[model samples]
Target: MTNVLVLGANGKIAKLATAQLLANPDNHLTLFLRNSKRLANAASDRVKVVEGDAASEADLKAVMADADIVYANLAGSIEAEAKAVVAAMDASGLKRLIWISTLGIYDEVPGNFGKWNHQMLDGGYLETYGAAAKTIEDSDLDYTIIRPAWLSNNDEVAYETTQKGEAFKGTEVSRKSIAALVAKLVADPSQAIHESLGVNKPNTDGDKPAWY
Candidate 1:
């Protein structure tokens, strides 16, 4: 049985991912969140809840103890928190990491959509996420960076995943799909290890629903 620690465990998609993780009889899941109260009643023998800020070194170290893999789902200031997570993982000697990032951090979103993403959500903050990704990528640890296009609340499972160069195509994808992707990463990370992968819902017209 693999013990997996999930950071940002209370987010919408994270919650779904948590469900999938819990469904796995062979996995021990830990839900690390700043406010455990926000999490609906989803805890059991296989699922444990730990309350603490992911950015706090002590808390991260404490929660990461004895874990085989760590799946990061924390949102907001992700770059900084990612750095902290790297440090904590390094300290704990847990070399497996599956991180979630934005699709266009590489500036590869394409055409007007890319321009708008850069103008609106991209901003200068992306440098931080990129740097954070670089830190994990360069480390001796095995890491898989999963970047998602746009997030939505739709309940669907059909979606596509790409490597570094492939375009994300769609404007938005369901959070549930992203969650399923995370669960897959947790299950079979070796295939994507030490690689960066992109994900999105393949669209017919190429023009998709606004992520906003």
Candidate 2:
């Protein structure tokens, strides 16, 4: 059985990904959220819920035990949080990690799209996200960093990925699409190891995200 650990399990994408993993009966899930009560309804024989801050090393280490794949869907002070996660993963001898960042952190978007993105997020949000990505890249653990375009609530699962250094495509993608990608990665952690990818909807390209 693949033991999957999901940090920020109460997050929208994380919840979706958890459901996807639960679809496979052989998969056991350990879900960690700041408020475990939020997921109490989901508790089952296959699901273990823990309440704790992902940024805390002790909390992270406690949840990392026996986890084959760790998917972190967290935000805020991302650089520090990533650092703590990486350290805990190393100590636990766990290698597979799927971390979520945002598009344009590396100026991966081109032209006006890039300009607009920076104008909208150029302050502390950008700095922390960039730092988080760099932290994951520098870590020795096998990681797939997912930089998703403006997220939409659309239920569609169609999306595409651009490798690191490639121009980020499209303007927005569905949350479900991102969750699907995470679930796919969990199923085969080796697929995008050591790679960072930008995910966006097909044919949704424009100067800005469609929601604008």
Candidate 3:
């Protein structure tokens, strides 16, 4: 059985991934978030919901004992959380990690869109996120950093990926697509190990997302 620990379980993509992971009877899940009450109704024989702070190494270590994989969907103080996660994983001897990040952390977005992306994200968001991604990349743990394009609530799963050094593709991708990618990784942990993927919907390339 694969024991998956989901940090920031209340996030939209994490919730979707949780349902998809649960569809496979052999996969068990530990939903970790700041307030367990938010997921009070999510507990079951195969699901364990725990309250904890992602930035607290002790909190993370407490839940890492049985986890085969760690999927962190977090925001705010992300660098601190990344350090804490790496430390906890190292201490637990757990290796697999799936981290949800944003596009342009590498400044790899190209053309006018790249400029626009920097203009929009440069102030503080990209800096902190970049530091967080760096923290994960520098760790010894096997990790896949997912860099998603502009997100939408679209109810579709059409998306593609670009490697770390490759220019990011398209403009936007649905949250469902990101969730699907996460589920795929959980189902087959061998794929994208130690890789950073830039996810976007095919044929949607532009200076901005269609809705903008």
Best by TM-score: 3
> Model 1 off-target regions past 4 Å?
204-212
Identify the leading candidate in terms of lDDT: 3
Model 1 clash pairs? none
> TM-score of the candidate numbered 2?
0.98
lDDT of 3 by residue, 37-130 (tens): 9999999999999999999999999999999999999988899999999999999999999999999999999999999999999999999999
| lDDT of model 3, residue 175 | 93
**What alpha-carbon RMSD in Å does predicted model 3 have with respect to the real structure?**
0.7
Instruction: State how far residue 165 of model 3 sits from its true place (Å).
Output: 0.5
TM-score of 1: 0.91
- TM-score per candidate, chains pooled: 0.91, 0.98, 0.99
- Computed on alpha carbons, the lDDT of every model, listed in order, comes to 0.80, 0.91, 0.96
Better of 1 and 2 by TM-score: 2
Output the lDDT of residue 119, model 2: 92
lDDT of 1 by residue, 1-60 (tens): 989998998788788888887778898988899888776476777888889988787799
